[model samples]
Target: MTDPQIERKLIEIMRIINESDRPVGARIIADELRNRGYNLGERAVRYHLRILDERGFTEKHGYTGRSITLKGKDELEEALIGDRLDFVITRIEDLIYRTDYDPVKKQGNVIVNVSYVDKDDFEKTAGLMRGAVDYSISPRVGVFEEDSEDIFVPAGKVGIATVCSITFDGILLRHGIPVKPNFGGILSVENNEPVVFKDLISYRGTSIDPIKIFLMRQSTSVTGLLQSGSGTILANMRSIPQSAVGDASLLFQQLHESDIGGLLAMDNESGNVLGAPVDVGLSGIVVSAGVNALAVVEEYGIDVTTRPVSTIMDYGTMKTL
Candidate 1:
């Protein structure tokens, strides 16, 4: 076949077109590609569109641009499967005998890596395993995806961020949000009341004109949106209610105090991006929850404008474990 990378991009383009409500031009497709971590141009995207059209995977509507066909849909699903199987099978082999499985619980942790590190340094760090399990060694068996408790990051400049677990990732993926590791600015926006529903509807606050905010359990809202960079997108992200959960400021506080990495909310119905929020992280972002993108590099905080604002690390899936 063609180079795997090219083949992947061809499928990716097909996938993007498949997800859109209407036919989208190459520019919009290219923008979506970049948001999902592909650095490509509209010209390059159109080239692939042409190839897909030739393959009968995409169809053009005069000047309305292209959309994916049924054959393309089948191809995309197969692509997602083929892309992940190798890694999943390898990780499975690594922990074939070490994990606890429950078909009912569906909870399990895979031993992804065994590495040596400074023992003193690991404990000094917050939000780690801490006293949860027995330690006493320089080598760490690192493969617990996340901690059970919610991690709270203080509000500040660029150094701050809202981290979510794989549990949260699946929710957004089921929504319109693409399931991929990504980092980008909100391109534009149209503000409205936020909701807790994955359907991207079902209101929480009616009189709260402008912001129909709610406490987001499954998804997250990063301060760095509105400059979505892509075309107008109806964004449904994870967010917290304006009121803290009991004494807990929760994730919403991070978005509110954002001098950097914070919530850039989007209205899902209108499909219009709202105005971009100011740099709550003009100084930086705080790690408000979970692990993964835990620390803030110095240069990144200086000015998150060009990039490194909010970060997301895609966690692998769970199989019967």
Candidate 2:
């Protein structure tokens, strides 16, 4: 077999063994491989097992079969790293396709960004989030108790879900308007007006969410924006065909009327959106980032772990911030 083919089979074999509760035999591993569409025979599986044993990735249990070792687990994680590249954009596209939100009636499942905060800081976090309502994708927010069944909240931590801006893309798509997400960036704001994107990370390039990266680097001055209207904030850019601009505008207005507002700027007749150049035949659309509220909580020295475009939730369940 070619090196790539052998590597794939070995990875699959290790995965099968890792998932089993007890040591797995070659016959069982071979059967599972076939179930997963790999037609490896028991003998081939045993051969691979010997290789794993030699490499100290697996330990043979006298006649009981074999178990994956700690080394094996680490290797597996490292090997799968390449598969995670561009995962952020893939997740965004998947959520957009899964969205069934109806802005006109404002009653359907919509995308949300999840955050975890210490239970003791929940009230403070909520208040801080309220201060940045103007910069969030929607005023509606969902708070889950530490023991809430709706979402998994870590021990002593509360889960907060915010509306993601991708909901706009989904809404436009429902109306036959296709939208292409461009990037997530830090937008410089002065006097409560957005100036330009100071830095941009294309959605197609990175595995980690750009907003999350910026937050980790302490790159935001959201507190300044909240106090003096001059600081950097998180934002996203999208592109839509020029012909659908009229329809998109009408939908955006309806969305605003429904209490969902994140529209920052759109391309004008000159094909420039807030000083950002747009491609021919397409208009660029910029909107407030969903995680901006979480950024505020972080600025206060409260710990927060954000999952962007994490999951979908009923719009009615969220309470206005």
Candidate 3:
């Protein structure tokens, strides 16, 4: 059998060609491979294209020298899921002054506050955001956000964060805007395990135009980060709306603001943060809620929130709990 790695590469090449709106040439594919630090020659790329055609993954056009096929699209979608792509969406809020203000030199800054979720969930949310952006204003460029910290694993964790940027013709106009003809397909796992997905979209403004303008600014900021070697992940993701009752919007906010090791203080009445436990040694903490529980304030009584509290630990230096 052919090496799985080599087959994977061939599949990736086909996917790239299919995902591209315009038909791409073999030379262009070869150049892209070279830019990615691969020593793939144009002849080798052409050979792979022929192989793909034989396998029914791609087809050559009658008159045009370029080609694309449904098989190619399916292969590309599979690759996108396997790779676990990362993306970012920024909402811009432009503050216009009543009097004369320099629009060019001085501009209002729009901060896109990001909340953490599972990698799959993040991709799904990003896809929806991209669709909104595409349908609203048709943005020419976009920014990418990189994962700076290590992936949170149960045991023996390593420091490696995947990030990437994609430039497409789209812009997300409003906060509560709904996506038409949703592109977010079936979100499933290889082992058939259930996964949690959340969508967090926020905007604080009166005018929609200024918000759209601010989105452009925020996109620029994210773009800058991607260009500066901070964002490094693949493109192509699925978009889903925030409609489920179990979305953990508030908890995510608390996690983002609190210190890495701080305790998650819960409010009994509102189920929100009354305050966190400071200077308290925590062994470990597990935050959980209902599968579709939206209002976590009172549901904490019915749901589950568990954590390990450490007692009698020396704090001056590193000591065992």
Candidate 4:
């Protein structure tokens, strides 16, 4: 048989054994394969099982069923990684809005806002003009200097609003604010980085307090993600709710307030998208925090399953913050 075909059967058998607390026989294996759309028979399965036992991938207990060995587990995980023939692209971004716009020139135009950025602090302050690059935003800088009872607004400064402009559906900002946001670890979903809430940004809806706190935890974990690499994230989730979140920029504002180190979220496809605002065009998503994100999800009685990654919705793309 072809190596790939043999490898496929081996991985499937390993998974069955791993999932089962007790030993499984060849007949059971054949039945399971048939249920999954494979048409292998018990005789064929036994033939392969004999080969597996020879390699120590399967341990046959005389008349009893068979179980997978440690080597089999390693082989399965390796196969999972190798089976990643495709990737879901997620574009990373920062909390942003157009800060540089002439109210006199482009008044009452549509503006877009997002809640995560990949640039460092102060770097975006100067170069974050309109269309600086693919994802950079141009917003007015609002520099404030309090003079006794009076307020002084300077031309450009960090963490301040500078210009006056109208925002439409997408949220064009006169004073655009971008905060430092981050995430760590990748949810191995097929071959793509996972996206939540259509943009990987999460916000409100049903137990928002705890969920917001969870997002903060992962965001702070970005730098410490073990053996992590940089990748661009772009999200495109369906049915983003605007009412749950008011302003998209505020989501990052809270993330900054939480002082998150980086991003560590999404084991795979997630329904929880955190840190979104109302009326910023993008919608809100609820996320959970903790080392076991799935456990947190299950605590709320949400059904979780492991399926082929192709079934998930297209969220957004992302980059290292």
Best-performing candidate as measured by lDDT? 2
Clashes of each: 48, 0, 21, 76
**Candidate 4, superposed: residue stretches over 4 Å from native:** 86-297, 300-321
Error of 3 at 88 (Å): 16
Residue 73's lDDT in candidate 2:
92
Q: What tens-digit string does per-residue lDDT give for candidate 3 at 125-172?
A: 334334323111111112223322211121111111111111000111
Worst 10 residues of 1 by lDDT: 132-141
Cα TM-score per model = 0.33, 0.77, 0.29, 0.33
Summing lDDT over every window of 10 consecutive residues in candidate 2, give the lowest-scoring window: 79-88
lDDT digits (tens) for residues 1-321 of candidate 1: 668778878976886677556887787777656544467898898888888999898999988889888988887767745554343323222233333322123333322211111323333332232221111111122222212111111112111212232222232232223222111121232242322222232112221101112111212222222223122212323322222222222333332232112233422333232332212211111111222122111112211111111112221231110
lDDT of each: 0.35, 0.83, 0.29, 0.34
Query: Per-residue lDDT of 1-321 in model 4, one digit per residue for the tens?
Result: 548667667666776667565788777677656533356888988888888888888888787799888987777666644342311111111112322323333332222221211123234423322221211112222222322111211112222221110121112233332221222122322222333232232312211122223333333222212114322222222223343233433543433332211222312223334322223333422222222222222233333221111010101111112
lDDT of 2: 0.83
Sort by lDDT, best first. Answer: 2, 1, 4, 3
lDDT of 2 by residue, 29-119 (tens): 8765653446788899999899888888899998888999999999887764554455557667877877888877778988888888888
Model 2 ranges off by over 4 Å: 1-81, 269-272, 275-277
- Give the lDDT of residue 245 in candidate 3: 13
